[model samples]
Structure formats: structure tokens, C-alpha cells
Target: MSQQRIETIQKWLKDQNAEFAFIQSKANLFYLTGFRCEPHERLISLFVFQDKEPFLVCPNMEKPLISQAGWAYPIIGYSDHENPWELINKYLSTYSFEQNIAAIEKEALSVARHEQLQNLFPTFTFVNCEQGIMEMRLIKNEDEIAILREAAKLADFGVEVGINAVKKGRTEMEILALIEYELKKKGIAEMSFGTLVLSGENTANPHGHPNTKQIKEGDFVLFDLGVVVEGYCSDITRTIILGQPTEQQEQIYSTVLKAQEETLHICREGTILGDLDRKARSIISNAGYGEYFPHRIGHGLGSEVHELPSLNETNNDRLQVGMTFTIEPGIYLPGVGGVRIEDDVLITKQGHECLTKFPKELQIIHS
Candidate 1:
């Protein structure tokens, strides 16, 4: 377990007037316990108390792996035949004999689990720990940023592979496969999300899926992909043209690129998150493509692809050093190709670091 993070949660519990809480989300479980796992249908949880050794509750099959992952605490494991919730309640009773207010990651805990928890403790006052955890994860520590930096390098390389795979008749799925195959050869087991290779009119959709469409001259090919390194994730999107562009195509690409570049220039500490979104939006709006840009500026990223502090027009949260997020601006016209330039960024003491350094300048792949 990370002693510092454990203490942070302990203090948060004390502040919330919560006797104890359940950290159920896998991301948070790894953050506090230094162990990451997907419970899938099985149960994997952590019980943090105000003044006691936090206990781990997981499937019996993962007991040894949990210990190997450096969780030095009491563990409650259940076999497939056992009722996990009943076992959890029995152990929780030993920790908190009688309590009314129970703190939990309300967002992560399902309604079914909440019902089960209420069943165990009839008189329960559920306290939401989601805010506390979200606030805590807002800032990235040096170690986390370090891993993120490396992850960003991999994301950039993935974009490069995508660009190189462009050919006269390569299918979108073929390009996607090539990117992943190359990344896997270099030891990337999983992408932060599904590898995306959108082309032609499909690029008009912000979250378009890769398909079997063959490349054609003058088509726009978009590569939106990321990879997980250690526990951190990196996301990037770069749109390129298959051949020389028309006047309108060049204008749209340059406008989107300018919006991204200008916004990134002011990404220093102290900028309001909302203001950043507006700055990018205004640039697109002034260019008469406001309606073409549908999504917000960007979203927070770290252990998960999307997290807290979404960059929208109303959130006034101030960016601080050690925070990491993406600044992606795009313009999509229905029935026409689109352009989106995304970069993973880290707020620094003085300015910011652009982790995904893949060139934003439009690349034209000759037919």
C-alpha cells in the first residue's frame, strides 16, 4: 500500500465524520493499495477505517496475488460457493460494531451493493466519499506523471505507426491492426481504449469506430488511440489527408490546428478550466465552424482514460501544477471530412508539458 495515499484516505474519513469506508473502484483500489485487479463478477474491495489496519476483501483465488502485490494487511477471501456479501458484513461488523453513517464511493458502489449493505446494517447513513476521492486524484504526483510521460511517448509512437500504415487501399481495420501489432511487439498489452482508425465521411463522427472501408484519394484518415504503460494512460488523435487537400479542406485543418495550438499556449497554471474551453470554442466559432465542433475541449486522464474536471464552459476549476489532461479541438462537418488534433498535457510549475509530441501539422499521404 502507498503509505501516503492510505493516510490521505484515513484523514478524509476523519474529516467526513465517517468511521470507515469502502474503496470499491478498481482505479482507487490500485491507487491506495498499490495493487490493481479487475474483480469482473467477483468481489475485490478495501475497507479503510479511521483508526485500524485496512483489510482487503477479494476472491479466494486472488489471495496470493494480493499478497504478492504488497498488501500487508488482513484479507477476507471467499470461495466461489460462499456468499461474499455475507462474509463482508461479518468481517465489517468486527471493525464497526455499531455505526449509523457509512462512508463509501457512492459513484462506484452499485444500487444492488448499496441495498446489500443496507441489509447488513439496517440503520445506515450513507456518506458519499466520491468527492473526496475525486479531489485527491485531481493532482498527479511526480511518480504518476513520470509514468504518464512514458505512456505519452507510446501514444505518439502509435500515431506515427498509423500514419505510416496509410496506403492506396488499406482498410481502416488493417491500419488499426498494424498499430496494435507494432505496439504489442514493443510490449504494450492493452490500449487505453479501442484503437480507432476512422476515414473519409466517418471522421465526421467524433467517436467514430474503425471499419472495413478502404482508403481513397483525398480522404481524411483519423487516428485516435492510446496505450497503457504501467498504470497510467495516454490518449491522442491526429487527422491526416490521404492526398493533397482542397482549399476548403486546408482551411478547416488549419483552423482546427490553430485553435489547438493557441489553447495549448495558455495552458499554464492559474487558467480557469472553463476559460480554456471558451477560448478554443471562440476560435472555432469566429471562423464560422462553431456548430461543427460538438464536444467540449477535453477531459481529465490518468489511471483511467476519462476522469474528473471536465473542460467545459461552466466549470471554473483552476488548473494547478501536477495536473494532467488533454487539449483536443476539432471541427466536423456532416458529409465532409473532419480534423481533430489532441495532445496529452501535464501542468508544470512554470508552464505545461505536451506529452504527445506527434506533429499537428497536416500530413498528406500520397495515393
Candidate 2:
């Protein structure tokens, strides 16, 4: 049961010598409890005690929705006109447990909220619970992996839609809209992140927003997007040529594909996480494009779009079975264009399996 996830939090609090936990992060709240919502500045939190049953605290209007989502526990709702913290103090009084010593997710709780909690219990001591919860979310379970697999397929579908929409004079936003419109037609609730469509020289800005930049004949059009399904997520990036590829464009695309593939080949259980980035960095460096590759190779993904076990050169952690992440490598030449090939994958006992199976053989969209 998902309730056991709260039990795990209880055990963690005891280990940390804390008797209570105040969870404020929506991601952690959804991971422990099956319900997810964006409170949007209003107070929404979960209160847990080591020896008592936990209760969910949310806005009064969301009570029915949360119950329908299957949270079979005590829930306290407060209207906009009421002080939620005061009500929280009243609920703690019922448990007969001292709330003086506690652990809280300092990462998610705001300074104003922390001050309010302090005003309620001036003598309380708070410890950090972020690492413990992140450790629990690091390795995904079977059910989560199943949903991610399904989400990955939809991400591939989005890429196909984007590829089909690529044509001379088509703006990046138009392609972006067509991809998302097609996805929504197929029942995808939302994208894991903002759908990225960068054309021509715009692709050189790896993190650039999709604007009205129009693609042209022989321009390199890049689509980096993802979809969220069942609270899990999938991310994939594919760059296509809009007509006959120039010799320079072909060389750059081939270099990025090789770097990404070389990294993917070593994505197996027990491999050092840092080694994966080094392998890709080495290949790109040898090709004289080292400076063009700026960001880390990839990051962990699960119920949240980004989680722990980040893939970079500084981390010495070894890959473990059941861990999932992305292997994306690219080179961006200033004033020209960029090429990035990314895929979501899971490390297995034997090897690795690609969650996104879209072909990466230099797709060229005819003008």
C-alpha cells in the first residue's frame, strides 16, 4: 500500500531522532501519498508523527478531490479565511505527542511558513528530511517503471508528430503546437516539461524558448520534448534536417549521435555514473567540439521530472539496477546550429533497455 511510504517516513524520523515531519514539497507529498495537486501559494502540506497516523492538510475546496484520489487517512481542510497553521496545532494536540523535536523538508517550506511554524512552537527543533526522502525516490519500483515505459511511447509519438510538421517556413511555435495538439488529442494530460522546438541558428541555444523563429530549407530543426502520464514522465530529444543536409551539418549530427551512442553502450549496472559523462565528453573533445558541449550528460527521472542520482563528472556513484535516467549528448556551434540526441533508459541486471525507441539515424524532413 502507498501508506507504507508514510511508514517509511516515520522510521526515517525515528532514525534521525525526530518525532514529527512536515512535508511541503508537492513531489514528496505525491510520492508518499497518491494524490497530487499544485496549491499555487496556498498552504498544502502533510503532517506525520512517528507513533501516530499521518494526516493530510490541504485547501478546503480540494478535500473531495483528494478523497477521490484514494487517500484513506485523516485529512484536515482549511478555508482561505482561516489560519491553517493554527488548525494544524489543534490537530497535533489530539495525537498527545510532543511536537518539540521534528524533521521537516526545509527545501520546500518557505521562510514565511517556517516563521509561522516557529511562532506556533517556539522551542521546536527542526532537522532536514530531504536526503532521506530523495534516497527513497532514487531507485524506482516496478510499477513506476511500467508507467514510465508507457509515457516514453507517447514521447516518441510527440517526436513523430513534430517531425511530420517540419517544413520550410514553419515557425518553431507552429511545430510545437502541432506536436502538443496531437498529443492532447491522444489523451496526454501535459508535457513533462515545456515542449522545445528550436530551428536553424536558434537550436544553438540549448535552453532557448520556442519563439517565432522560422525554419528554412537545409536548416537543422531540433525537437526536445516529453510527456507526463500517470504522474510518471518521459523525455526525448531528436534533431532533424529540413532538407538536403550540408556536409558540415551531417558531420556535426554524426558526431553528436556517436557521442550519445557511446555513452548509451556503457549504461549498465555497476558502471560509475561519472564514467558515462567522461566517455561522451572524451569523444566530443577529440572531435574538437568539447567547448560546444556545455551541460551535464543527463539526470535522474521518475515521478518527478528530475530526481537524485544526477549523471555528471563530479559524482562518483555507480549505476544500480532499477535506476533510470537520460543519456543525451550534443554540440552547439555558435551562429550555426546544434544537434542533441537523447533517450530515456533503465539500467538492468544484464544491461540497459531504451524507454524511448525512436530511430536516431539522422532523420531528414523534406522541404
Candidate 3:
């Protein structure tokens, strides 16, 4: 755990006149405490104070794991049968606050949970702390960039596995399973999200899922997957052709690749973030495939697969050094197959680094 981060949030709480801040999201918890756990339906939170030391509340069973993750603070744990809110209230009630204001993760907290907190502190005024936390997490430190590079290497390996698994008559689900199974052998415990291996017409759908559709000659196979390493994530996408490609297929593939590369070429500090999307969109539009292209250029990547600083045309944020995100450009035709090229990019003092190093050239696999 970084004491500096803890102090940073405490300073923010003081500046906001909030006595304490409740961090409930798993991603934020992992960010602050260095402990990663998926407590589905279980109460787990970190309470930071403006003038007092902080404490963590979680299921009693996870106390040891949290400590093992190097959290040096008071841990208030409750069993499944106990009311976690009561424990939290009893512990926090010891401190007398000058103000009744507290900060909460408005995005992660549910109405029921808000009511529970309200019942505990009847006069407490809850304010949104999610945006503040996001601002802190937006920039990548050297250590974080190191972990992301490793994750990107693993994501590249996953794509390699998927491409090699493609075979005549093999179903899309079959190839997806092969990719994850191979990754597990290499010590990957989890993927950032569902592994996607779309074949032929399935590639036209931006959010296609793997299924029993078999691979065949003259099909465009797309692999989009990522792996999580040490709480960080890497996302990548690559599309390949089975057998020979027609003129239209080659044009679409080349257009998407050009769009991705041109956008990546302009990445650096002080560049308008939205212009990256505009750059890619213009390339696709000039190629007469604008209507077929949907979605933004990309999104920020870090502890969570999809995070802040969205790469959309509407956002006017400037790209800063230490900021990491994806530069993905694609063109999807409804009846025909589509092509996408995605890379995890990190803005550097000089220019930018493409973390995911899997080759982007269109590969034609002989079926």
C-alpha cells in the first residue's frame, strides 16, 4: 500500500470538508490498499478520514488476505451472519467529527447501502468522491507502467494463441477456449474480460461473443482479448483472414489499419484527446466507410479494463505524459466481415509507447 496515496485522499477529504471518505469499489480498493478481491454481494470498504487514521471493513474471512496485501491499518471484519454496517458505525462513531459531511463512491454505492449508512449517521451528508479518485488514478506511475507492460505482453501471447488455434471446421468457441486454456498454463489467473474470437460474419458485430459457428475458407477471424497481471490489465484486438481475401476485404482491412496507425502517430503530450478519435474517424470516412465505423477510438486502461479519460470526440481533455489508453480503429459492414486493430498506448515524455506488441499486419492463414 502506498502511504502517499492514502495521504492524498485524506488531503482531498479535508479540502472538501468531508470528515471521511468511503471507498467501496473493488478497483478503488485495490488501488488504495494493494489488495484485490471480488466480494460479490459482500460488504467491503475502506474508510479514510480527514483528521484521523483510516480503517478497512470487510468480510472476516478476508482480513488475513488484506493484511497480506500490506495494508497497515485497523481492519474491522464481520462474519456473514453479522450486520457489517453496525460494525462500521460502532468503529467510526468513536471519532467526533466537526462536520457531518462524508464522501462516498456515488457510482458504486446502491440506494440500499446509502440508506444503511444514513441510518448509522443520521446527519451525515454524503458527497461524490468517485471523480476525485478517478483523477488520482488517471496518470500512471513508473511502477504501474511496468506492471502494465507485463500485462500487455501476456495479452499479446493470448492473441498469438488464438491465431494459432484457428483451423478448418473449428468453432469460434473452440478457439476461445484454446486461448484461455493456453494462458492459464502460463500462469494467467483471469482475463480482463470475456475472450472474443469471432469468425466470418460474426466479425461485423463490434461486441460479438464466441459461439459454435465453425471456421471455414474465406472468413475473417478476429481475436479480442486481454489478461490481468498484478491488478493491472491490457486489452488488444487483431484480425486475420482465412485463405484468400477479395478486393473489398483487403480494402477494409487496410483502411482500419491505416486509421489506427495514423491516430497512433499523433499521440503525445498536449494533444487534444478527442482529436485522436477524430483523426481515426476521418481516415475511415475518407475511405467511404464512415457509416460502418461506430464506437469511439478507444478508452483509458488501468486497474479496470475500461476506466477514465474516454477517447471520444466529445471529450476535450489534453493527453498528458503518463496517461495510458487504447488506440483502436475499425470499420464494420453489416453483411460482410469487419476489421479492427487495437493497441494499448502510453504517452511518454518523447512520444508514446505501444505496449501490446503483437504484429498488426494482416495475416492470411492457409486453411
Number of backbone collisions per candidate, in order? 0, 0, 0
Q: Per-residue lDDT of 11-67 in model 2, one digit per residue for the tens? A: 988887787888989788888887777889898888887887888889989999888
For residues 244-352, write the lDDT of model 3, one tens digit per residue.
9999999999999999999999999999999999999999999999999989999999999999889999999999999999998998898789899999999999999
Positional deviation of residue 71's Cα in model 2 after best superposition, in angstroms: 0.8
Candidate 2 residue pairs in clash (backbone atoms < 3 Å): none
Clashing pairs in 3: none
Model 1 TM-score, all chains together? 0.97
Residue pairs with backbone atoms closer than 3 Å in model 1 (clashes): none
User: In candidate 3, which residue ranges exceed 4 Å CA deviation?
Assistant: none
State the number of backbone clashes in model 2: 0
lDDT of all predictions, in order shown? 0.89, 0.89, 0.93
Q: Which candidate wins on TM-score?
A: 3
Candidate 1 C-alpha lDDT tens digits along 1-367? 3777788998988877777788789888887787777789787888888888888888988999888878888999999999988888777665654456778887789898888878987877889987888788889988898899999999999999989989989999999999999999999998999888999999999999889999899999999999988777999999999988999899999999999999999999999999989999999999999999999999999988898779998989899998899999999988888899999999999799998998889899996
